[model samples]
Target: MKIDAAVCSSARLARDRRFDGRFFTAVKTTGIFCRPICPARPPLERNVTYFATAAEAANAGFRPCLRCRPDSAPGSPAWGLVSTTVQRALKLMRGEREPQSVERLAERLGVSSRYLRRLFAEHLGVSPLAVWQTERALFAFRLLRDTHLPIADIAYESGFNSLRRFNGVFKQIYQRTPSEVRREGHSSRVDVRAATPVRLYLDYRPPLDWQPLLAFLGARALTGVEQVEGEVYSRSFAVDTGDLVRYRGVMRVYNDAERNRLVVEIFGQEGGTGLYLLNQRLRRLFDLDTDIEEIQAILKEDTLLSSQLRENPGLRLPGAWDPFEYALRAILGQQISVAAASTIAGRLVTRYGESFVDDSGTEWFLFPQAEQLAEADFSDLGVTRTRAKTLREFVAATLDGRVNFAEQSLEDWCTQVTSLPGIGDWTAQYIAMRGLSMPDAFPASDLGILQALGSEGEKAKPKEALARAEQWRPWRAYGAILLWQSLKSGEQK
Candidate 1:
């Protein structure tokens, strides 16, 4: 997590958007840490110190800057460069409820608490508990500033056990009580019972090729379950909140390219941790946390990928909204055109998915869960018998816990997934790249990738493509995306 102070100083002085979340500038005089892109006047270099993460800054007794709101910055790139253990730990924490204790988290990770703590300390410069608390506090602070949710509800939603603890942590980190901070930001309070969509904004690093990303989603968008209109992408979601409770809702994401953020509108009966989970999913779906510059630096070294990289500078690896859903989609897509696969997927949703009607009487379909389709018949949905059998077996394996989406290592996960019947390297690699958010997962056998790498209207063999992709190690997923974009731009032979 070491940072170059000179580089940080220059980024801070230039208000560089690319370095927004890579590091934080902690001011000695103000005792506040700001994003590198903060609008506030530059502080003296002597008064500024750089921290690799906001948690590290908070651990050093520096408050988050109200102006820059470091919490809202794209996730620190340092998270991507950490050890596999830390990466898995972070994924688990962000994907679900925080484990009750470091012991519990360590147990789940199959490592001892002492070892897990050491990894966190070495990489993050903070304990696991510190990271968890900082995340919760910062999430609550964002809610206070952006939403009308009551303080108590915000506390519960943000993972705080009680209002007292929430206030204490809020004050400890932000140097102000929750109410005081809310008032200072002048956020209007509203009734908790009101049936209004909760709106929130997520920030990302700049040079986002937003239209291309949207086009990618729209092409494969499942009918009735997802819709893309104009610049907005909307979909229906069903998030399980345990105890047989589920929050079903529709969320629409709008591109705010001018501001370098996406404005998300959530239409649902809001209360509970579902909103928090939804936020994480949306961030992944958009791949907002990736460091485009870093990925480009490596890919641009090759002539083939370099041309595509220059054509689409800020292209991103589009992620899945749900792993199970995307895995099913991948299975459905095997050896078929994208349009044909999407047509069958739409039929599957129409048959097995749940219907949700919003206040406007507009009906939407929620993608079916594993249990919903475990034993269900898909023969009538224009699916081949072989594909149906594969789908059934995949769902059964998922239900029986043989296929875990939360697995840590990409190689191990891919191996386990490919072991399942009819699921090959391509499906597993696609799942890893988009579903699991593994940056290194590359499907060398992908037709589009092979075609993009070929010459004179010829497609390269999988072996040739894999060989050429060796130079893009640890970022082959992004390379795959660039290749796909090249096909769209007619840059490929």
Candidate 2:
């Protein structure tokens, strides 16, 4: 990744929040890398060097700045801007329990290890392993700062094989031992028990349209499985450790707007690794890694979206908690209103979903797993016979390895998914947009989108809508979100 020194210098001096995770400032004199929004006095231009990723800076022998905590910054929005291959690789890497060998990872991505290494080198100025190592070390560091987990537990949870290795990695990256960092953090140690909830924060770039985002989730929230009360969004989650052990819990997230982060409180038996996976899921669920400004710049070119862009400056694409669950919801929602889909979904959950009561005595239901719904009947849940068959087939495909949520090109994934019976362009594109977090995925056939693009109270035909959306290519998903938001705003007025 090429970094324009002059541009970085200006942003560094200005402490621009927009540039926070886009790049990191490595000060040669201090041998430390900091976020662009670091509050420390700006370093002289001569001592400053910019790296497109914190991993690059760490590989360059720079320690993370204690003051700014680069690990806590939003993920680099610039990551996927240039290479989709790199983007896919990253998504895979973040969700892995242990970093796979380059050969294995490349095979999953349909690329040779050599070519994958070259792509990482060209786009991130680092090897894939270096990126993985940095991510692991930083995640452990975050655990140190945010939770009271024992250092040993943090080690295993952060994917370190042993306490010594964890210490060595922390020393190499942060120039401090895990114990030192924890002590410096000054958070009182609390015994982590199965029932005790752990609190953590997930940060994002500013101008987040938080309340509206919550409202969007609240409207589509499945009863018992999800609850959105006031400004808080809470849900029950189940994390399969891939080792035959599954952990269940409830998590609540609310905005900390003043600090530009969300406070996540987890009540579960998951250790570090499970929490790590949950973090990734929540980040995707809220679309926290997006650079809204950069996306808006492209979508604003469309006259249809421009007004909504101004009205909802930091609108985010709300993502699914689980791809399979959301895909089922989309299937249930075919030719139905949002409320109707949600009602059916809630009934499905009540039927097949696992039930648990938290310490507060509040009952919560986990979204039904594929196995649970595979042989189950949905006819009694108010689902039409055709829709019920589609749901069962979708679950069967998921179980038979016909539908994978793994890393793949959006077009390929869409083609593979739409091949199934009853799933069409709109459903596939909708899944791609939210389920797969594919930004360019757009459902041109969507009623709401067509209505929003239509003029004088006439709905645009899907063909016309598709043609008009051509200009929004590579960002059509955000365009879709803008159109939907605009439609909602119109209804309210």
Candidate 3:
């Protein structure tokens, strides 16, 4: 993550949004840190210091800038490319109830606290606890500026245990009282009422191909569970508690093109915990945190893929909202068309999914759980007997804990999944690509990829296609997405 000073300086001077999350700048003279895309006056080169993360700048005793709000900047791409332990830790930190201590966090990652701190220091230039505190502070800063929530509520919502601690931390970081900071820049505040949806911006690197991604999701969206209309992508979800309780809600996310960021509005829940978790889910679902430039650098080296890459530079490999649900959809879609699978999925939901009604008068359903789907009859869902057997086995395995979506490495998950009935290399790889968020999980046997890579009028064998795709190592999934889009775009011509 060591960025060249001259290059960082140039990005800062130009106020480049492209480099927004790649790094942060701290001014020694002003004692303030800002995003690379900050709009305020640029500091002198001698007074400027670059940091790979906001946590690092904060660790160096620099307060966040009031105008730029480094906390709201797009997350660093380093999170995507880091080691598995760090990646898992990052995901866990986003949970509503995070681990109590660095030791606990390390225990979750199966590493000692010392080693965990070493890894964080190496990659993030800050301790894990510092990173967590910085996240809380910044999230609080965003709430203070955007909403009319009570300062006390904002404190607890931002992970502070008490009002005194929240106030002290705010002053320590921003050098101002929370109320004062809010009042200083409260002109654009929204009058947040008790029932209002919590709205926030999730920033990302530019050049997102929103249309193609929407089209892909729209075709496969299950009725009552998910919807994609025009620019908005909305879904109903449920989180099962340990004691047989479940919290249900609906989320809506869409692009604010003028702001160069995605706007996420969470309804049916008002706590910061739900808001934080939903934001993480949406970021993953949209693949917003991917380093497209790094992927494109590898992909463009392939002469065969160069043209497709040029045509859709911003194409992203979409991830799943719920990995289990998506894995079931993948099974249902084994060899069928997307539309056919979606229709059957809708029927399956109607038969077994839990129902809920939103405030907007739209009826919604949560995707069925493994326990419910295991014994359910799929005969009426428009699937063949063999496909039905496959799904039943899949559900049974999931219920029996033979198939786990979490706590398993990507390689192990792929191996275990391929062992199931009706699941093959292609389906397993597809699951890994979307469900497990493996950037390199390329399903070379996919028809779209084979069709896109054929020679003249001859289709390539799966083995040959896989061999040819070796050049796209570590980013073959991105190449697969671009290739798939090429076929879809070609069909419209």
- Weakest ten-residue segment in model 2 by summed lDDT: 187-196
Report RMSD for candidate 3: 2.8
**Which residue pairs overlap in candidate 3's backbone?**
none
Candidate 3: Cα lDDT at 280: 68
lDDT, each prediction: 0.86, 0.86, 0.81
Q: After the best TM-score superposition of candidate 2, give how far the Cα of residue 18 lies from its true spot, in angstroms.
A: 1.2
Tens digits of lDDT, candidate 1, 54-114: 9999999999999989879888889988998998888778776433588988999999999
- Candidate 2 total steric clashes: 0
Candidate 3 residue 371 Cα shift, in angstroms, is 4.0
> Of the pair 1 and 3, which is ahead by lDDT?
1
Q: What TM-score fits each model?
A: 0.96, 0.96, 0.92
What are the per-residue Cα lDDT tens digits for candidate 3 across 165-191?
Answer: 889877888888998977876653545
Model 2 quality (TM-score): 0.96
Worst 10 residues of 3 by lDDT: 484-493
Cα lDDT tens digits, model 2, 352-397, are 8889998889999999889887788788989778878878888899
lDDT of 1 at 107: 94
